[model samples]
Target: MAQEMTPTQLQAWRALYRADTLLFTHIENTLRARLKMSYFEHEVLRILDAAGGRLRMAPLAEQLMISRSGATRLVGKLEEKDGYVARRNTPEDRRATWAELTDDGRKALKEAQPVVEAVVATFFADHVSNEDLRAASRILDVLADANPNDDGFDCGL
Candidate 1:
């Protein structure tokens, strides 16, 4: 049988897992009830926004830890809502498609930014000190490096 985790390991794992779960639920619910956007949606917008308002479908999927088809489906839904997004073929690579954030999408993202910031500050950041955040980030990086195949990094979002 495999050995059990040490107390330090367990604490770190539980703290990160619990915090992520609770934060995701709280942020997603707040967006859904107040802004009619899912937390995933906000994340996509933020990513695209950070990437100069455009990112290819595959990279976006990889960043979000979802499948290609799932990304397409989610983008399709958002596309219908007043042209929030536009999909285009990458001329150099027909197989690669791009999702460009439209003006409406940017507007929506701008509006949602404060809501997200506030919720995050209230639920996550407020409880942690600056030094702890730095240490947590480093610990997470170490953890992520140990599990490279997982492709989920705290630094990504």
Candidate 2:
């Protein structure tokens, strides 16, 4: 038989879940209103921006903890809406394509930065001490490392 959590443990789990949900909700709303971008969309752009402004589809999918198809779909949506990303066949591997962030994508990211930064600071930083933040980061990093997939959830579709 599996051991049951105590009431305190259950409460702690619930609190953490609620906190995470609220944090994401807050960020999502802010991003949608200010930048017309979903959280996932923002994340995609941010990752591309950080990766010297381009990345192969497979590597980008891995880095984003998403499947290739999922990344392709997301990239397609971004391409349709903003024309900020393009897919090109890799010269080294004709079978593979690269997702490159366009100049417009860089500009969109730059425009969104201020709003995202303020939201992050207000919702996360203002509430947590530096030590608490560092400890939380360490804990999450450990949890991620222990998981079979670097992503916490199975990308079942």
Candidate 3:
């Protein structure tokens, strides 16, 4: 059985929902205008860049909180349309595959980062006090581990 949420928890959930919706909409629009890609795609590129510009397919899917098929489809778009990403088979295990960020993907991520950083600074950072940030960080960190599958941190609406 599911535990009931306290009234305060319910209120917090509502507030978080509203704020997240607004924030993502703003960022997604900004990204669409400048980068011509969804925020998720941008995130994939960013993650690949951070992971030495490559990651195995299974881990990438998990990190993205997407099914393997979904990850493959998304990567396929990145591969076919813009050549921003590519896949390779491992010689040792032909069944194992990896996706790598191309130079174009790196350049695209670099271009998008400034826009994202500026918007986050203006809308999120400027309003929140340092104390509030610390408190929220603690709360989020607690919530981060609540997922049984360990995929909760990445899959936000």
| Candidate 3 lDDT over residue span 1-157, tens digit each | 9999999999999998888788888889999998898888888898899899999878888878877777888888888997889999988999988999999999989999998988788778789999998998898878856764464343532
Stretch of 10 with least lDDT, candidate 1: 148-157
Candidate 2 regions with alpha-carbon error over 4 angstroms = 150-157
What lDDT would candidate 3 get against the real structure?
0.85
Q: What tens-digit string does per-residue lDDT give for candidate 1 at 34-85?
A: 8899987887888899999999998888777777788888788878774778
Q: How do the residues 1-157 of candidate 2 rate in per-residue lDDT, one tens digit apiece?
A: 9899999989977987888888889889999998789877887889999999888887887777878888899898888888888888866789988888999999988888788788888888899999999998998788668875654342541
Which ten contiguous residues of candidate 3 have the minimum total lDDT? 148-157
Screening candidate 1 with a backbone cut-off below 3 angstroms (N, C-alpha, C), the clashing residue pairs are: none
Rank by lDDT, descending?
Answer: 3, 1, 2
User: Which of candidates 1 and 2 reaches a greater lDDT?
Assistant: 1
Clashing pairs in 3: none
Superposing every Cα of model 2 onto the true structure, what RMSD results?
2.2
Clash counts for all predictions: 0, 0, 0
lDDT of 1 at 123: 96
Output the worst ten-in-a-row residue range by lDDT, candidate 2.
148-157
